[model samples]
Target: MKIVIISLLAISLHLTNSQITSGIVSDFVRTNLIGYPLIHEPKTWIFDPDVALKRRKQFVDLHGDKGEKLIERLGLGIDGNYEERLAEQRKRDEGHLGGLNAHLP
Candidate 1:
């Protein structure tokens, strides 16, 4: 019984060691040999601008005037054209394509 337990433990240790070594080797190859891993790439920021704009549009749409008022509270536009930005947001909100019936009406 003791011999069986010891054998099982030795096998488990071998497997765990192999797994750790394989993980280290794969990570090294991915970063150094295979150009780069996806998480380490720099161009991730510039890949999708429209998705970001769409998210901002959704936020302004949901919060409405209350949202604009909150932006003013944040003291972002003490002298700059806040009203112009608000108008631009309004235009964007209105221009979003809603439904198939929109074209018919």
Candidate 2:
């Protein structure tokens, strides 16, 4: 009986720890991956641009430009030049779509 109780307690603790670890990982991804992109280029997503910008500002205020440095390290482009890159992406997208339009009536 004592052995069974100890095993059950161990199992419970393991499960609890797993839950905490998973929560931390999810929060990390949400903040770093989803939040960062939304903040970096609000034009791409349909969410309120102001909210993204505000969250980005909050992140910067907290993290002190680490996000921008990470983006640069990843070779994604500079932080402040999102508009230029976005415009270039739009032009590239339009160019690809333009060829398809020529095929239609």
Candidate 3:
């Protein structure tokens, strides 16, 4: 009976710790992505493409391949081809701006 009680107590503590850690990590990620005033205005300061690319590079440098896998698991649409995505976005934006310029003058 004592062994069983000890086991249950350990399991409860482990579960509580896991929950707390998960909550902290979720909050940190949300704060980094959305900024502090998320409840009021939802300002996405770190949501810019350049900022995201920089952060991605830093993450990859710090965590190596595991970082890439983590990013993939996060379902952020970054499938380890950040450069390709950035290039594509740049081309698209330039094309759009070029079209606008053509029509302006």
Candidate 1 per-residue lDDT over residues 23-77, each given as its tens digit: 7656655776676667666663557758866788677776564485566445446
* Top-TM-score candidate index: 1
Taking all chains together, each candidate's TM-score versus the true structure is: 0.22, 0.20, 0.21
lDDT of each: 0.62, 0.63, 0.62
Global lDDT of model 2: 0.63
- In model 1, the worst 10-residue window by lDDT is 95-104
- On lDDT, the stronger of 2 and 3 is 2
Error of 3 at 40 (Å): 30
TM-score of 3: 0.21
Per-residue lDDT of 58 in model 3: 79
From the highest TM-score down, the ranking of the candidates is 1, 3, 2
CA shift of 18, model 1, Å: 0.1
Candidate achieving the largest lDDT = 2
lDDT of 2 at 92: 63
Model 1 lDDT, full chain set: 0.62
